[model samples]
Target: DLDLSGTVGAMLRSTGGTSAPIFGFGIVDTATDVKVTLNDTNAFMVKGSVTEADLGFDNFRFGIDDNAPRMIFEDFGGTTWQLDSNGNNFRFFQAGSVKMQLASDGDLSLENNNLDNVGVIFLKQQASADADVPAYGQIWTKTATPNQLWFTPDGGVDTQLDHTGAFPTTWSDTGITGAELETLSDTSDADSLHSHSNHGASHGNTLDEAYDEGGAGAGRTITVDDGSPIELIAAGPTTKVIDILQSGGGFPELQLRPDGILFGPGGGTPQDISLTRSGNNVLALGASDKLTLDKIGATTGDVLAVQSTLKLAKPLVLDKGTSANIDGNDEISIPVVTWLYLTSAGATDNLDGIGAGTEGQVVFLTVVAGKDITLVHNGTVTAGKKLMINGEATVTLDQDHDFAIAIYDATATVWNVLVPGSGGGVGNHNILDGSVHQDSVADGVTAGSVIIGNDTPKWDELVISIPGANILNVLGIANGETVPSWKSVLDGTNPAATAATASPGTSLISAHRDHVHPIGVGTTRGDILIWNSTPVASRLVAKTAGAYVGGDGTDVVSTIPKRTIVLTAAGGKEATTAGCAAAAVVEAGTNDVDYWVLDFDKDTDEFAFWNIVMPGNYDGGTITFRVYWTAASGSGTVVWNLKGRSYADSAAIDQAYTDVGETSTDTLITAGDVHISPESAVVTLNGSPAGGEYVQIKVNRDISEDTLTADARLLAIEIEYTTDAISDAI
Candidate 1:
């Protein structure tokens, strides 16, 4: 070797005592690019040279124990970072007594910490300058004393929250004082300064004294500034006054006027207010006035009165004696009583049980049972109550036992009955005198004439009965003469008969001329009756052909006939033949086949028909059987195909018929198509089978390649047409 190298290693010795090696050097993996250098100025410097590109980047690591890297510094893809791992593969770790970690899987864990164990995790806030924030901010602590908590403010004194007793120990609010509290508590002295105090001018006062200083029982006057004077009740002043003092402490007394006159406290003159009158039976308003009463008249000053009798239109009748008031001028009947007592008396009717009367007022007493009755005034019977007959005193009803009239004497308060002989023997039954209530018929005169009354008796009409005599004969009417009996006419067999001028007798035969009345004879089915010109009588005539007979009155019978033509199908008139292909079998390879064809006949097709029946059936899958119709002269055509499975029900068959040109294996017709069975499908061309025109109906079958059978068959087609011409057919 031509080159010469001197030092393989260099070292610096420490100048101070007890100092370890200040400079050192080491190499790893026999690579000089990867090494650690130590010097006095710099701490340990571990690095990899740029030449070590295979290491991806550079990594400086420190470790312990097996020297496994506990912390690593790396530069990868231009991003340099440090990674540290705890022995448990945790990315973050705390080296405290109780280990805590953030695992590589992003799980944060603390040893001996869980929900069931000590769940206290203090979350604290850093100090802030804001006054609203506490110096220590929020602290969550689960291990605090029961019902007791600590609270601290940033710039305030600490407080203890104690929930040890009933709600509010003390409360404070604006505008509230201890006096207000006393008012709220019932245990407080009721007479305290706060008790029911007037709230000054700010609120309102309940006392009328206008000030709070008024003493109890102090007198005060309320003066109302209203303009009107106060009004006092005109009557019952003592009872109506408001005594505004304690227990008869008494209000101001009012003075009375000795002369029954009242004056105001400061009045100008005296006024009379007395309410008493001095008359014995009168009411006078003035001090020097007098009222007098007499019988039914009263006189006071210029006043005068007159007495007149008042009478009721219908007097009440009492059959038995009873307590009841009688209306003034109204009568009460004591019916045939031997003894009668009149009760409480009055001056007017229906007032009391007694009859109303003034002095000299009269009432009547009657004995309806034809017996004498003694009447007594149960009220006040006196000498003035005596009845006088011929101006003599009497005590009983009149001997005639009819009625007695009496007058009341107000002076003695008695009724004086008039005796029978006193007033012409109580004229209950008066003789026929012109004076009053006299019959027109003479007194004591007896006759067979009916008597009428008018205050007098007279004859009105006389009725006489005769035996076994005719009315006309009784009237002495001669033959050929008529009597006026217009109001007395009678029909057959009436008891009371009335005569008529022209038809007096009952027989109608006498009033008509003789004539022969020939009755009608028996009629045949179609026979009509007509008038005969010569005999002038009705005779039956045979009805003409095509004519019907009916009644047109007694002898006017007529008839009209109609020709009924019924259309019946003519035998052998309509012809049908096979339609479609020459044979029923559709060979396997045939995709479509023409099966049935109907050739129409002009003679029968020109008229209406019932149907064109085509007998056919099918056997295949997805086979289409089509029916085509040609118009008369083959000018137009209509094609329709059937649908459904071979074993489809009637509804499916009907749907198939309606769904024209439909592709299906079976169910190829309408109800009228007459699908008797899967083997027999009779297509009935309902009445609309191209009637009145020459039509050719053809049936086609289109079968798929996979169809079990390649064709459909149509047997004979018969046209069921009516023989009747279209003009007369429906």
Candidate 2:
């Protein structure tokens, strides 16, 4: 081997010439392009001084094959170097392994998942990029919002690099790293121990300068933009899910993952958030969402909320959802997050339950006037639709002006009423901010609605002004004390009752509760009247005693005046066997006219019991029932004994009957004749009978005292009791 420079010595003979050069065969080219060719299985090589040296010797070779060209350099050592041009691509090989490739389409590919060996050096560009795109734009597009770095920028206005962008090598080969990214920096030194001329300070990957306070690289903000979501996975390498954990110190962290956005308190217990969709949940059973439906097994749609309160600002409005009876039943339903615009029908409308309710949900309900809706506490309104209001059953939304509030309980799966609904627009006011007049009281103020001074949390005094100051003077009153009278206002010496004569009052008087005006009108004698429907404009009906105010079933209630009510024996239950009074029927002609009766055997002395709820209108007194029965065959005097007990709410249901019953003797005048017995003396109830309480009355016949040989077919019994109202409060 000879090393010669600046000398025309012959080492290679020109293949294009017929003759060789003297001294040494060499080829020289004066043309603009020159070519070197080696046939197959031949190589232009350089080797150590060894005879007949093969590829195993320390040598380097520039070889050619069928449409392939490669240059290999080896020193009898491992993984030297090789550059090959085959498959129309440029590849660098180390130890016969492809380390990097420059594709024909101008892409530089590194075959690794990490750039750990790469160092922060001068950025370079790929000139083969598409003409319209920026240099290295093909790879930079992956990072839509590229990261910025200050690897080793020279400070000053005339610095070569702007230091506005960075070259950050990620864990994937598709990401470009060595690109000459633009960056902005005052001073930076890329060397491990060198100082920058601009700042005279050293900064590198060393621990001493890594987190220097107030340094360019210290406490800098890193912006992670939203593109194809950035995911925070495990510290180790894996595409599968593995929890990113803290040291169990209970630090809060939010992370993006395959499942969804997860939030973990600490110790690796990350929770996925569930977002709501418009349609009903169609998630599979045991899926993260729709877990509430899986829990309660309810087919009705509901909202599952994990938070406590849903607050809204003032003037808050919502789409009014509808609520009505379910298929003519007493049950109803309205989605959780909504206000109810309710409509109802029925003489005694009942709202026993609400459906489609979720745990920790609140509901508001309203009813119009005359639409009586009673929410029964512990009512029998089927499963998945149950409620309890104040532990009592009188929760009725009686008016339209009022609304009810309720909360749902998952464990009990029932709505617990917070504010009981009172139908008919007659409940506590839903107060809002407003002003009320506090001026001196006037005469005309007693007619229409007005605001007045009252105390509230936000105001000193403000409330609804009830026009009732002088209501008694103008209110319809009967002749005696019922309606207003001219004598009430005219005072003494006022003329007697005359149809249309007016006797004006001598002096004015301040209105008082008992101040009845002596007007020139009269009314009927009965309990005060109550409106059955919304009052018509200026429609004045004279006060009548026929209709009294009552909140029970929809019916015009009236004062009994006689203090007596009659009930037949058919409404009572019979005892068993010897003491049981059985029901018997009688058929007359061929058409079979049917008539029902209670037959008490003369030999057994059977008894019939009547379970009664003393009407709300019942005035408390001794309740006496007479047995109306008939003789089927033989007849004699019949002795009927009455005994019973009353059981109020919470009273012992099995209380014993009265010690001694009142006995009445009635003799049968003729066979098959209806006999009347004297009213038995008032029999005392064991539980101290009272109005609106439950009473069980048992009537029996004494066989020893009665000579009736045949069965006594009892027709009916008349119960005598007094009522002070139309009916019990509904």
Candidate 3:
């Protein structure tokens, strides 16, 4: 170890040589204690634990020249050394196999780098050892080609490997020099080898002859022996006993041996034995073998006698032959029993056997058979279907009373009793005698009766009887007749009859015509007959006047004062003395009714009035009466009496008619003109009015001038006029 304790500048230096172990180096002030400096202002200090021995002097400077080996302290522990080059650290070790390499960042590396060889190196025993070569536990090797290791022994007493063959020869123990012999021994049975003579004999090859020939010691044979008859006595438990023995074989017969099996102590008594085979290999004991109790004597309580008062907590039953008898007197004994019977002969009389003492008391008896009860009643009896009393048992209803019976159906529901003959008779006949009583009230008869005369009468006959008349008296008449003859007597009074004659004493009025004549009394006419009145006309006219009236008779005869003379002229006395005596005679002033005198001048053939006082000229008035006029032979216009003025000029008035005609004609006046105004006359001009002077004017006539001749007759006159001109015009 080189110590740089008091180095000032350079302790060791070397110039650059070709084979020197250094390049360049410098000292770093790696002091942790005091700051070191090359100059006073440029000082540096290291970081870590430090001592004075860590640095030679506090501020000493150390350097290495070129080609010089420099020492380096790698770690502060001071056990490692490294080389220095230009202030970089390179670790080094004294052992070459152990290396320390420094990384760029000052990390150290210590590793071994080597390669192993390619073949197997086995640690084997020596080939010259006389002892057997020990085997090494299996060795794995690698080879370039497929190969194997085998061992082959040569022909010798001792086994040795023979190498005379190829590289992979098999070495077995055959034909080996110095080879030991392989011996096999069965060590499990060492004595089997010495005992081979007794092998066949031990496996049952020998036998005793006596056993083969059925001697006393032969193998047991399956056998069955008839068992000795046994006595079975059954005693202790009960007086009666039964035992059973099973049999095997062909009928499997059961035998009741006379020496019955004994049971109980010493088998003193033998039980009655019986056997019966039922089906399917089963056996049953007969009735004789059934256990039965003996009837004991009275002292021994034979009938299970209850001497004291025995109260039965439950129902006591005696089956079949079991019975009981009462012995003591004054005994109010009671025993609950079921299915007990009381003696009776006929069921009909049995109900009476229940004793009159139990009257009005309810008793329950269950009958085993149907139709078991027969009740006889002298009074009304109602029986349902379940109460099947005998037929001869009369159920009489002595008096009028209502009876009802209800029958139960299969479901035990009671239904109303249905009476026979409820439906009407067969083939629509009347069956039900509902009239059992005269005033019987039958309700709910919705259907009408079919009997002919009972309810419904024959066609058209009244079913209801009329008072004071028998229903037979009603007549059956066909419809649409006026009066049907009465089949029975008519009552009350008779109706009146009409007479057949017109005269009172005409042969006793035999077939006399009583014609229905109609006569008009006032303004009405209807059926009428002769009444008690005067006769206005005779029946037959007599020819007592000798000659018949030549024409329609018209003769007048009167007695005048003696101045009456008969004046006869050439043609007719046409007022021959027409103007001989004429006077205007105006009668004394008439009140409102007056007669104006007018004359027709026959000589002049004109109408003339003598002292005719005409009324005032009325403006509008109508006149209706008979007016006669005749036209004389004339060819000029004739002016007749007129009432209206002229139509052209109101001043022109005419008392005679104005006319206009085309021919010389004569006209007759029938109806007057209707004057509308005083100036105008609405004239229906009849025949043709003459057109010029000397023409005739015919007014109020219906004759056509074209068809009329000069001999037409005139009739009456009628006219209509307006009364109020001003009001009527509007």
Model 3 residue 397 lDDT? 17
Q: After superposition, which runs of candidate 3 have C-alpha atoms over 4 Å from their true positions? A: 1-427, 431-527, 530-730
> How many backbone clashes does every candidate have?
29, 38, 37
lDDT of 1 by residue, 161-227 (tens): 3323211232111122222222232222221111121122322222333222234422233323344
For model 2, the local distance difference test gives 0.51
Q: What is the C-alpha RMSD of each candidate to the true structure, in Å?
A: 39.1, 28.2, 46.3
Looking at candidate 2, what is the lDDT of residue 662? Answer: 79
lDDT of 3 by residue, 1-730 (tens): 1224334222232223323222212332555233232222222223234443333313333334265444434344435343444335465543333355576764444546342569864533332212222432122222213322223112111222323322112222222111111110122211111100011211111112213323444322312224422222333443223222222122222222333333222233333222224523223444445433344232422243334466544454433221222112211112122222221233322221121111112222222222132222122222321222222222211111212132223343222222121111111222333332212233222243222232222212223334353212333344564433333334333323433334543221122133343332433232223322243221222222222222223322121111111111111111233221122222334444322222233223222211111111212222222233332222222222322222222223234443331222233332221111122234332222211111112222222322222322122122332222112211
Instruction: Give lDDT: candidate 3, residue 563.
Output: 10
Better of 1 and 3 by lDDT: 1
Sort the predicted structures by lDDT, highest score first: 2, 1, 3
- Candidate 1 RMSD to the correct structure: 39.1
Q: How far in Å is the alpha carbon of 693 misplaced in model 3?
A: 28
Query: What lDDT score belongs to each candidate, Candidate 1 first?
Result: 0.32, 0.51, 0.27
TM-score of each: 0.15, 0.25, 0.11
TM-score, candidate 2, is 0.25
